[model samples]
Target: MSYLDHCSTLLFFVQHCGARGRSIGVLWFSLPSWAELELGRAPVFWKTMNGLPPTSGESLTLFYNPAASNLAPNEEFGIAFNGGFNQPIMCGGEPRVMRIKERGEADLPIYTIKIQAPKYAVSLIFSFTNGVEWDGPYKLQFQVLKKWRNKPIIFSNEGLAEELSKEGACEGAIFPDSCDHRELRN
Candidate 1:
C-alpha cells in the first residue's frame, strides 16, 4: 500500500479503538522517508497536566515540540488533528495551509490538513476544534506551547507506566488480548 494509504489505515484504527473507549497512551505516526525529511522526527509526549474540568468551557493545553529535526532555511511543517478546520494556534507565527484531503467512511467525515511553517509549539485548542468532548474517561486536554530552545523529548512505555503508577491510575491498566503469550510461545 502507498504511504498515504498506510496512514489512513492507522488513523482509522486509532479512531476505531478510541471509539470503543480505549485510551491510546501512545501513537506512532509512520511517515515516508521523504515526508520525514520534510516533517522532522516522530512526535514525543512532553508532559501531561491537568486542564479545565468537563464543566469548564476550555480544558487542558498540550505543549509539544512540533519539529525537533533540522529544517531547511524556509522549509515548513504542520500537524492536523481529527476535528474541524479552524484557525491555527500561533505559537510564533501564523499557520500557512500546505494541503487538505477530504475523506469519509460510512457517515464519518475526516479531513487531513497540513500546515506550512508552523510554530515549534503548535497549540491544539479543543475549544475551537470539533470532536468528541473526551477520549474515553479522560477529557481531551493538553495544548502545545512554544519553547525557547527546540529539544526533543524522549519517552518509553515503561516511563509511561511509571507516570501512570505515580498517579495511581495504573492499577486497572489492561493489556491487550493480542499480548497473550500462548500464541507467542507457539
Candidate 2:
C-alpha cells in the first residue's frame, strides 16, 4: 500500500483502539528532510494554546485545526495525543469544532477546534495528506502546557515547546525531543 494509505489505516486503528481503552505498539519511520520542513509550515498543523489550564476558573481553549483554503485535493486529516494521567484520552469527551470559513476578504480560510484538558499535559500529532508521493508519511508534533499549578507533570513529549516555537501558543509548551516511529511518519 502507499505510504499515505498506511498512515491513514494506522491512525484509524489508533483512534479505535484508544476509544476501546486498548494500546497498540506502533513502529516509527523517518521522512526526508524536505518533507519535514514542509510539514512544519503547513497551516493545517498550526496550533495555539490560548491560556493556561484552569485551577478552578473558566476553561482554557486549545486550538487544533486546519486552514480551509490551504487544503489540497484529496486531503485527509487526523490528530492523536497522549493525554496525561489526569486528562481524558483523545476523542474521549466533547470538543468544540469550528468549521472552515473565510476570514474577511483575505481568502485565508480559518478553521479552529477547541479542546479543554485540565491539569494534564498533552502531546499532539497532526497528520495531513502527503504533498509528495515519495515524501513518506509526514506528521508534526506539538504539546500543551506541561507544568501546571507550579507542579511538573510528565507526558510523552515533555519540554518540547522550545524547539518548535519562539513565540505564540506553543511557547513554553512541551513536545517530543526527537523523531521516531511514534511520530506521524510512514
Candidate 3:
C-alpha cells in the first residue's frame, strides 16, 4: 500500500509482492506499459467506501476513472466483482452497458457501477479494465452485523438501593473508617 504524494494527491503504487507473507520485497523495476502507467504515474481510479460495512441486501455505488486514467476512445472500461465476471452495473432497472458519464471533473468519463452487497459475503473483490488491458484485484472487506434495535438500559435508583442493602459491601471489603453501607442506602 504505497503512494506517491503529488501535490497532496496520493497516487497508489502497485507493489507486486510475490508469494511472501510480508509486503516488503524487491521492487521489480520495468519499463512503463501503456495500460499500467500514464504520464509517469499509474492510471488513477476512484472508488467510494461510504456505504461500506453494508448489511445484506444493500446496494452500493462505485465510480471508476472519474478523474485520471485516460482511456482510448475505442477502449471499453468495465469491472468484475467477486460473484461475477465483467458484469454490467444495473442502473434504473437497466444495465449501463459500458456507457461513460461525462459528469465528472474536466468532463472526464466516469464509469459507474451498482453492486448488490450480499450478507453472506465476507469481502468484495473487484477487477478493472480499459478494454485493452486489465488492472487491479482491489478488495473491499465487509463487517457483517446483525440487525438490532438501539435499546438503552435504564437502572432504577430504588432497585440499586435494594441490591446494595442485600450485599452490604463495607462489611467484608476494605474501606476507610468513615465507610458505611447506610450512606449508600440513602
Candidate 4:
C-alpha cells in the first residue's frame, strides 16, 4: 500500500462490517501546489458535510462504482469536484452549483460552478438535476453530474446560494476507479 506521502484526493470505499461499517472518510485531496489549485471558496463555511455520504443514514455505505464513471483515456486519472470542507473529517457543507449555457460564444460547450457555506450545516446540499450534454469521445472526459432536482432548498439549508453569492460545483468521481458510485451496480 502507498504510504501517505502528499495531500491528494483519496477515493475510499464504503463498507459496513460488524454493523458499524467503514466510511471511506475524508477524500485526501493532496494538491500539487497552492498556485496550481483554485482553492478560493473554502473559508466561510461552518459545519461537516460531504455531498455523497458513506453511510446513507440506514447503515448502508456507498462504494465506488467504476462502470458508472467517466474517464479520459488520454488523461492519467479522473478528477471529480469536492464540496468545500474545513479539514479532514469535517465537511464545509454544500456549495452553489451554477447552471450555465452560453449562446454564440455562449454555446461553446462550457459551464461554471461556484460555492459558499452557511453556518451550522452538517452536510453539503446539492442538486444533481443540472446537466450538460457533450459531443464525441472527448465528452467522456467530463464527469456526469446527478443534476440534483431539488437544489434551491438544499442550498438554503446550508446557506449556499445559486445566485449572486457564488457559482460552482464540487468534483465527484471518475471511471475505472471503484471508489466512484455515480451510477449504482447490480
TM-scores for every candidate against the unseen true structure: 0.21, 0.29, 0.39, 0.21
Model 3 stretches astray by more than 4 angstroms:
1-53, 66-73, 76-99, 147-186
Write down the worst ten-residue block by lDDT for model 3. Answer: 85-94
Q: Residues 42-143, candidate 3, lDDT per residue (tens digit)?
A: 333333345233332344554455124333333443432222211111111212233355653644454555444433333344444543434344443333
Give lDDT per model, in order.
Answer: 0.24, 0.29, 0.33, 0.22
TM accuracy, model 3? 0.39
lDDT of 1 by residue, 15-82 (tens): 11232345554433432233332333422111112321211112222221223221111223222232
lDDT of 2 by residue, 48-123 (tens): 2343222221133222222322333224423222232122322222222233433467434434333222223333
lDDT of 1 at 144: 21
- Judged by whole-model lDDT over C-alpha atoms, candidate 3 comes out at 0.33
Q: Candidate 4 — number of clashing residue pairs?
A: 37
Model 4: residues with Cα > 4 Å off, grouped in runs: 1-26, 31-97, 101-110, 122-186
Scored against the true structure, residue 88 in model 1 reaches a CA lDDT of: 18
Positional deviation of residue 183's Cα in model 3 after best superposition, in angstroms: 68
Clashes of 2: 2
Clashing pairs in 1: 61-142, 61-143, 62-142, 62-143, 62-144, 63-143, 63-144, 63-145, 76-117
